[model samples]
Target: MSRSILDEAHIHPAVRSIVANNHANVIAEVKAAIASNPIVVVGMAQNPFPRKARRVLDDIKATYVYLEYGSYLSGWRPRTALKMWTGWPTFPMIFVNGILIGGANDLQRLIASGELSGLVAA
Candidate 1:
């Protein structure tokens, strides 16, 4: 199936501009928030964890940031910031409205039983 939530010729102009102009910043902000929140999940991309986590985020129309350690620590030493925020050392962190949802196993359990959708939708 299609990953897109949009229909052809029905693009919202404001959303298009926001996506184009501020995508990077938006992603960064979400990443930082995930690092800080207790209701978000963080994991590795190569791990199966992120696949389902990503699907849930997409299903709920949630915006997320997928970060590698190097990129996450690129300019301002995100490791320090992340440590201060989450106290956890990991990647592929998922956040919703700036809340942490735990890691891969946690996400899997939530997704398998459909609890993830309820939380995300809320």
Candidate 2:
């Protein structure tokens, strides 16, 4: 289930370099957090969904690392880099056991179905 991306050769070399290095540091930070934590919630400021996701995790007594980017007004570029990296278009990108399990509502479904406990337990 991999997504399609433009081939490197299709992009000009100069453009390729820029794309490669675009917000690399932020991506690195996120990569480090994901590597260190089994449950990582990548979110943004002023986004209600991320907070809702956090609350859900709290109710389940799940331990997770949360990383928030810029709010609606600012920091969209840095967050865009994240969107390019993960291919998830929405905020509150929640990952469990190093795998993306979608956002808050998805999280709720997993919990309601008794799958979230198994995921965290694993």
Candidate 3:
């Protein structure tokens, strides 16, 4: 999937300005993390799913980066943009190798199915 359409920097100048102004450094931070980290988790402080996902990653000894947004702050704008961009309707948007992997439940399912282990191993 092409990530350019979803990236704030690549979007329209007006939209990019809005997201940048509202989110400050979230978009840049997320972009950097996704580019540099093999596994990235984007979630909010109030969301338990991200924490659960983190726990699962830790249990599996997976190297990942967790980007925590806000439940009630300026960071929520970037979170909303990311949710829209990814077309995912929940928190803890997990990405493996720059690919979306759903949430904690999805991670658990992958773990149960042994697919996540394979991905992490590779």
Say which candidate scores most in lDDT: 2
Model 3: residues with Cα > 4 Å off, grouped in runs: 1-25, 72-74
Model 3 misses residue 72 by how many Å? 4.6
User: So what's the TM-score on candidate 1?
Assistant: 0.45
Model 2: lDDT of residue 114: 96
Off by over 4 Å in 1: 1-28, 31-64, 71-76
> Tens-digit lDDT track for model 3 on 1-122?
64434555567886766655655466677778988888899888877789999998899888999888778555666787777667788888888777788999998999889998677666
lDDT of 3: 0.80
TM-score quality measure for candidate 2: 0.94
Candidate No. with top TM-score: 2
Q: How many backbone clashes does candidate 3 have?
A: 0
Residue pairs with backbone overlap in model 3: none
**C-alpha displacement of 72 in model 1, angstroms?**
11
Q: Please list the residue runs of candidate 2 whose C-alpha ends up more than 4 Å from where it truly belongs after superposition.
A: none
TM-score of each: 0.45, 0.94, 0.74
Candidate 2: the clashing residue pairs are: none
